[model samples]
Target: MEPTRLVYEAWKRTEKIIQNTKDAKGNEIVREVEFYDPYDVKHMEKIDSRCFLCGETIQEGIATKHVFSDVFTDWNRSRYPIGTHVCPACSFTILTNPKNRTSLRNFSFVAEEKLHLPNRVEMRQFLVEPPEPPFLIVLAVSQKKHLAFKGTVSYNREIYTVMLEETEVIINRKEFTRLLAIVERFLFAFTKTEVQTGQYNQQRVLKFGIDRWEWFEEQVKPYRGTELLNVVMFVAQKVEREEDVLCFMGLGQKTKTPPQPHLSFMPSIEAETNDVDQADQICGDKLNDSQKQVQSEQIQLELF
Candidate 1:
């Protein structure tokens, strides 16, 4: 990752931390400073995100949220700085222009998912002095709607106040359950398939088993033809990430094996059977060991 300018604090405890740096002449630099890690504080405010339009419970882990600027016509005549938001299907319906086919693509959504997460840019922490309460916390959040661009960050927190760039999202019991379900599904699907068959790490290798495909399809098919189109668009955006994971797991690649001379299976089988019988009659214990080895080899497709 490229270096970016950021002020980071090292947390010693929930209420102790130290901010150890500052910018120098437009160059990112660290200096001697100290504070407490507020994360260890016994009491801290927690937040949760719900669908503003439909009132449906949005899962925090998989829920899509984006950040965008809404124009304000107040004294400042400034844009309501962008902030992170829940990408509700209903909210899309309420905020979008149906007549403008590309309006959704152009507006709303976090311009990019990776950029939307606070922790994506790794900020190094240093200990120049002691530690403060309510120090900076790195958070990752997602909206149901995909960003139009792949790497944009939202500044919506600026809307509420200049102090916070975005409101903190509080996680709750129901949201935790939803996140667990998605993770479980991903794990099961990951383990059920062959790891690298023909070719390796190709996007086209993202084919899923019939059952796994059906599971994902069912959840998404409901909105396949919806006028709101947010869900459909979001799924399309997720396709790239899905492909990346499949490749990372070796599901989209072929395993390599050494080339060896081969014998006909029929002849090989007959010879092995004859050899086993002969060994059994001649050396009982050694023959038993040999048979066990052969059984294991059979189970392993004789890869060795």
Candidate 2:
């Protein structure tokens, strides 16, 4: 992570903090900073995303309520800085508690048939600090119309704001890598197939089974086609530290094993095997002589 010219506040429970440091010119400078402000929030965008705090499915036009990050404290206060979304029910809970991070609201990922939802990113007693043992929180983007399920941070949070428009954010390479890892883990299931045959059969029998995730090499990874990856990868690269997230989407630890080699069978397809072959034979039996002769020539040509 490359260092940037910026200031960060170590969240203090009571007293404000100050530190003296020398700048590029070796001139002593004093800076005042405060930790992430308490949950002053705004409305959510009506569509394109599910609230990270609440398991609310959002849609457009029908619901005029804009889904927004619960941040802005005062309605008149113009500094409605970017934040993660929370639905009305969850929003009321937070308004009553102001600082509550944990929710009874259930979360899920479309990544796997049976998914393990990660733990919520706990609000520290002070400010944002390095996790004791690194953990993750997963967020899902709802699929509607022709859209497919996607993993993301914030839908309303504009990417270019942190990039082109200067903000208090300073990003480093380590943070970028961490975000990419989140995307790869949440979206990994798209690469798998139920019908295990040829190359696909080999891919499903991953050594780690459900516990492990496929790695993303950037150039090679494709989820919901490459278009989705490009948006996510760009968001991972561009967003500020606030967007750096991981989901402990797993309910609890299970005895993870390297799944046995060979392939797991698809019962639906395997069960119909005899029926398909029998139908084909029946069709072939009914062919007239001229039709049979034509079929034979087509088969010969295919072989040739």
What is the TM-score of each predicted model, taking all chains together?
Answer: 0.20, 0.16
lDDT per prediction?
A: 0.25, 0.26
List model 1 lDDT by residue over 37-120, tens digit each. Answer: 223222222325543322334443112222222441221211121212322232232233324332222222111111111111
TM-score of 1: 0.20
Q: Residue 75 in candidate 2 has what lDDT? A: 33
Model 1 residue runs over 4 Å out of place are: 1-172, 187-207, 220-304
Candidate 2: C-alpha RMSD after superposition: 23.9
Model 1, residue 287: distance off in Å is: 36
> Which one wins on TM-score?
1
| Candidate 2 residue lDDT tens string, 72-143 | 223331112232344343343122223433221122111111112222111110012222211111232221
